[model samples]
Target chain A: MTLTHLNARGEAHMVDVADKQETRREARARGSVHMQAATLALLSEGGLPKGDVLATARIAGIQAAKRTHELIPLCHALALSKVTIEFTLDEAESCVHVEAFCRLNGRTGVEMEALTAVSVACLTLYDMCKAVDKGMTIDGVRLEEKRGGRSGDWSREPMPEPAAATSRDPSAEAEKPAEAEKSAAISPTSGVKIQFLAELRERFETAECVLEWARLPSRDIAGVKLALINQDPKYKALLNQRVLCARNEAMSQNEAAVAPGDEIAFFPPVTGG
Target chain B: MKIVINVQQDAFNTEVEQARLTEGRSDIGAIVSFTGWVRDFNERPDVSALTLEHFPGMTEKALHVIAREAGERWALQGATIIHRVGRLEPGDAIVLVMTASAHRRAAFEACDFIMDYLKTRAPFWKKEHTDSGSYWVSERQSDREAASRWEHS
Candidate 1:
């Protein structure tokens, strides 16, 4: 059976550029990951037991490029000439900046393949370190530049500032190698680079904050994951918090109970899922 | 004629393209160049490092695209792209694209055109590890907006 505009269930389509060129082609793409200071420290020291975060992510990025078809369903597998992944320490924000570049000599452009590499790399880091920090975010995955075929020449727009990804003093971080050395004993790895994230501390709030079981003696709040129905930019950071380890309070389902005059109704679980 | 992509190699720094483009003849008036470096920040002060990833078959394809684009947009004699991959420190040369044109305007504008589009549309993801946690640079609306400028112009 031949099917167009459908891959399996909903609908799918494959873009064909078979009539194009065999000219030399290359693309430069960049994306970024925002992480906590501790997480950055662990990565720099190469302390995470799961593996070298950057190395593994590097490998994953390549694999993701190869498997973009599987993940995205219709991407064409092209013979890639080269793949390069790099990591740079951003000391000011305690984060790592990842840039991926892919190349191929084929009919179709490799933008999706390049993007897939960046996406997979970020996800791998998140999966490996979600235990410690929850504010991790993936950003700026875009086509930095591309060349090849009938499209002739195409480039990305200029950022407001060339150093759009700004941060504090990271090069000086090497000065305090002692910090990394202290953590080195934590594992066979050498001392980790003690990076620092300089984001301001944020506050989390919710309209329908409630405990799952208000009546339980132990406060049966273990299995529930926190959710916010609607959030403005001011509190969007709250969504980034994976699991709050703080001694936070949760009211019963439906609505939280207020003491004293009991003027407000506690936020309850959404009426619908 | 010869180009290289380096990662902390002890071999050379010969920003040789300058001499190479000029070659034996000194008549070539302009050599436009762009050198992108790893900065210390990523919007948040806690960012400590950056990790760049690429697709093996496609990485070269994309660079070629940028090179070809530079050629098409300007009156170019020759151009080369040298982008390093792997772990890099702050101040390291992340990418170098150079164009040699008969006149300064063609070389300079072509070089700027290449970099402008590269910054916004290139499909590479950069993940920053900060003190607070690790996060991906959100896809920039500004980047899209920037790229859009070329479409109308």
Candidate 2:
């Protein structure tokens, strides 16, 4: 069936929810920002020049939840009853985990408000810390759970362990030490290098695929993936799935431009709560 | 031109929005409205619900820009955009776009133009949930193509 936002003529309109029953709705969302260890230290120590980073982010998130209707064009105006933003410092991972909760007694659910709060909080954190670490990455934004509304209640399933790091293919495991040594031997040079991460790393035993400047004429993500697949056809099926590409440790699209000496990585979609 | 943009987690009353657009405006001869609802399935048939996300400061700015651009291209008397964000079940309303003008053609075209631009330019993202897992919905190539046509037109 076509979406209700679209009329029979395929035009967009707001749905009339005056007849729907009001219910107490609550939702929670989580995301994380990964940064350098030094940057994390600065954050934990409250040494950031921006004063208190988490406090600022928490306020920004709350304000963002209140203004959600302003940001999303089709959202109805809702008076959110409660909005809370919390942060957890994972020192071992050098990451700050953000969680947002939103509540409203309305006809619709509050998941978006919660998700938006988490996203803005993460972005605010990035802005506050960019002076110290410009390489931080924001990822794993998703809805963790929701309650109330016509859908009853829903919760996300626990994510499986990343296949590449955990599931050791016996044959691949036996050869990994030698392959790791080979990868370690190849010093960083003024040439294109491709690395498999997470599950992809386990699938591709070589770990790193270093290419001479002459061989990497087309420095696009698809070209790099194609080159890797050419070296080993076993990656054909894996590459066909929805794999994320990154250039120089930043998330990028498949058509993103690449250059010599760039570090490229391919990994499965990130799943974190 | 009158433009109204709303973003909230509650469902909106289309009748009220439509009445507000045309109320006492004797000059309006035609009103075009569009409503989008959540479908149970996308890419897969098992989707139980959807979670939508948007950029806070940026989404409203983008929607206003699109509404203003539509006003410039068409002689619209009134326009309203209401988008919902949060968890939604099958058959739940997702969005509403309405346009009013002195003539049917202008109202129709303006509404279509706003929607096309909103789909691509808006910062909203959708994530579909199934029994086993949930995944962020990727923008379809067709949506990009649909929005690009406006650039040339």
Candidate 3:
């Protein structure tokens, strides 16, 4: 694709949008700042040294969005009808999610403005929290979506998991450290464990029971249920009710295969919101 | 896809949950959310309180499965499912489901799909306290049918 903001000589220049139609356009951008859990708690409780980190960040984001054109060399200045900067505090990850929205009826897209807002917001957060958490990291800054303009609407697709760091070099694996820290979700050689949950536990009176792999009649959930019933007739209650089964934390049908050291759970249908 | 699943006893802020899905990303063109609240009348009008019980580890796993399936079905950028357990009074929020995508339809449908599957597949039992007594809430046939429709579509 040809560059829109460049002349044939390749010198950067803003494209003339005078003839472009005035249409409603909207854009959103997001980013995050990771910090210590204690830092986040202090910020949330208004105990941060900066007095109010989120409020300051929000104001900074809005101001940055309005002045995006001034900061960027070739961006066209358009009056944004609305600019909203929002934040979400994540306790488990000790991070703050920042989002910005820019909307207007104009010729140019506001994606850059929204992105600028989020970037400034994250930077402001870092500035306010740096006193307490010097190692905070600001990342994941990107445009979430845009609507209107001649190119039409666009949105980001789901991101794929990051590629393994050492996988790029095939020889690195041979020299890598021992694999003792491998995934603990699935362990080999241990016998299958059956777990009863909620109402099922109340009826069965046992939270969990293990079965030897070699003694099982089969390796499927149906077979496991039969074996469990043989051990205790009360287990037959599960068969009578609309019991649901899960193999290794995923919903599984009765015929789903199971291996040694796998976790199996049975419960009734959910009535949650 | 970014998926966040939380099963806790504390209340969740809808706006914060929405921000969790949309923040720091501009590629989402549309977002749809559904919040379920504890109504004063469910099976009876004089209900005073409700208690939600769920399988601890399995609850989060089941919600993850549901949210992941929604992400697979739709071109979703992010999804969140927060379900509250423990005793809840009337007007308390019980669950929140949010889906972000490029188009309104995908976001709307994914949110609906998550709620439908969550109601039937998630291992949560609700017991409502009425004027007469408290009883374990029964699964609705409509919820099952709602979830089944997605399979054919």
Candidate 4:
């Protein structure tokens, strides 16, 4: 184990990379922003109110790569040769995947720069969409591969399967109690399915189910919101501001009513663009 | 006016910085200092760590310009800005801004002004590590608003 930034007195200091030989170094990192399907549609269709989400995120990522040293205290400032940020819009999984690559002829590895680019790009995506979907999550940010430096090249083991796709389905992973199955029982008439996504999933664990309100509570967005809060007061504060409610995968305001067979999803403001 | 800017990867000594600003200074009357630390929680709870990055040569240059601007805007005996880069945990000092002046207002305003400019103008990015994953911190609208107050003046 080596702590490069510590001196004889164990005080923190910048490591002197001045004596190290300059070599071509490259690194790749990846992360993703999970969101609602409707939000994904808005991003892909260029309908986000904040303008081009992908374009803005890409620029943010590239800019972050060049400024890595200024953000990380101990990093050596090197002139980066190239930086690239790419986004994969996976509609089926309801997420935007980000990957960044950084290259330079310098004494230090560019892994941190690459990781920073991916991180910023993901954050920019969240910022652009937060007003509409609050619960978007940024996850799995890691250095996928790196080349050059004294230790040589390294790469992460191949994942058994893409985690992004499976992570979107909270119901599959969450332990369901008898109460959840009872709530999931669909009535012959006037019943609707309710699901919570992202941050809401953690808050309303096993709260998702099918319900039949005699009056079809979804008649106004407020009715559904109140009902959910009534079911669990813990959800009241979250619903009041940061969380957004949706009907059948489309953005719905509190005034909008729910219809039978409709799917209701409650989520927080999306932070990923 | 005396200006000092340091960009490093290790932790800094606040007492040393305070002493440096007041050393051999009989003309100074008031000294103001501000230190920022990484918060354990931002937007979400369970933040495990934070990693900071920056542009080396350019970051130092930008900080110098910001310090000079503070000096020009206020009457001061000395000022210091020390920003740490690299991986930091919660409660670790991320930045230090200190100012000394004959009066408290100049030292106070200058210190506040420097931080406002530093947040938006500095070549730095921060990533928060949480239990579930890590995220890059979004530039806050509040930070922009704070920086913009100095635009007209």
True contacts kept of each: 0.00, 0.00, 0.75, 0.00
Instruction: Write model 1 residue lDDT over A154-202, tens digit each, in one string.
Output: 4442222233122123443233234323433343322111111112121
Stretches of model 4 off by over 4 angstroms after superposition: A159-273, B1-153
Tens digits of per-residue lDDT for model 3, A144-202: 66767876654442322122221324443333222212322234544778888766776
Give the TM-score (vs. native) of candidate 2. Answer: 0.39
- A32-101 per-residue lDDT for model 4 (tens digits): 9999998986676566799878889999999999898899998877799989888877767899989898
Question: Per-prediction TM-score, please?
Answer: 0.36, 0.39, 0.52, 0.38
Give the alpha-carbon lDDT of every model.
Answer: 0.54, 0.75, 0.81, 0.75
Encode model 2's per-residue lDDT on B1-153: one tens digit a residue.
677988888999999999988887788999999998888888788999987765444457667768877876777888899888878889898999999988899999988888888887665767789997886666677776777888887
Docking class of 3: acceptable
- Judging by lDDT against the true structure, name the best candidate: 3
Give residue B144's error in model 4 in angstroms. 44
Q: How would you encode candidate 3's per-residue C-alpha lDDT over B79-118 as one tens digit per residue?
A: 9999999999998999999889989999999999999999
Cα lDDT tens digits for candidate 1, B1-153: 222222322222437756665677655667878877777776687667665543333335445555555564556766655555544556666666677777999888777776666655333445666778765555556665765676675
Model 2, runs deviating above 4 Å = A1-273
Write the residue-wise lDDT of candidate 4 on B1-153 in tens digits: 678899988888989988988888798999999999888989679888877766545567668767867775677778899998888999888999999999999999999999998987766667688989986666678887888998887
Name the weakest run of 10 consecutive residues (lDDT summed) in model 1 chain A: A264-273
Best prediction by TM-score = 3
The DockQ value obtained for model 2 is: 0.01
